[model samples]
Target: MNKAVFPLLLLSFSSLFPAHGSGNETAALHRRYASAATEMHRVQVAMDAINAKLICRGCKIDVVDEIFSTDFRLKDQNSLGYDGKYSEAVYFDPPKDLNQTNAAPERALSYRGWYLAVKFDKNGELIDYYLTNIHK
Candidate 1:
């Protein structure tokens, strides 16, 4: 194999397997909603939500950006100190971002691993559990 092709081949091979994929780890989150994809691939060392359990449905929003993103917001190092492989970070408000998007979960939950976009009804009670993503 040519040296140049070798590097490309390596990249392709690496891509086949996610460096950090989902795992069997189970995390109990305090947040209302959660995403399977985020949890599935959250482990610093390969982990995924294929066989894990989280707050909301263990699901993935096809159009990720529509939900939550750090695109315009600056990233911060501070954390809520919540320890878990899965998070309940919601990011989108639906009306604006969901107007035009691909097939995804009913609601958007944690985007990536940190951000959470929460929504409340008339009352001020937490009411998003299992409502963020689709249930499998």
Candidate 2:
């Protein structure tokens, strides 16, 4: 009976330790995850680049220039809306840059608390942008 119990205990202990994957298999899994992460990052960058080059829907304005221009002015870094969304306001100060573009229609209310709001992602990629008239 003691011999029989010893064999049973040995079998139970052996079953407790399951076989692990080979080193190559583990490395392969890691490589797959790394590749997937890299692909996702590349896709995000491409989408952001496309958006950065887009023209404004309201007036075909060059949004890239407006955001990147040295003369760019802003009332605030972010504006909160009724919908709980935050927007960045681009203040159109004197010597307005909008007049230099033919595509984007010039506005008479450039100084009456008018601005272009832009939102960017953590990677500094343009996500959403729009025009807003907020009385400063």
RMSD of each: 17.3, 19.5
lDDT scores for all predictions? 0.30, 0.42
- lDDT of model 1, residue 96: 38
| Per-residue lDDT of candidate 1, residues 44-130 (tens digit) | 111122222221222232112122232312223342224312223343232234334557657444323332333222222223332
Displacement of the residue 81 alpha carbon in candidate 2, Å: 14
lDDT by residue (tens digit), candidate 2, 21-131: 344543443344335344344233323323433422221223333322422222233543554433454454332343645666655334544345665433334446655
Q: Which portions of model 2 show Cα errors greater than 4 Å? A: 1-87, 94-111
Cα deviation at 101, candidate 2, in Å, is: 36
- Give the C-alpha miss distance for residue 89 in model 2, angstroms: 2.5
How many angstroms is residue 38 displaced in model 2 relative to the true structure, after the best TM-score fit? Answer: 46
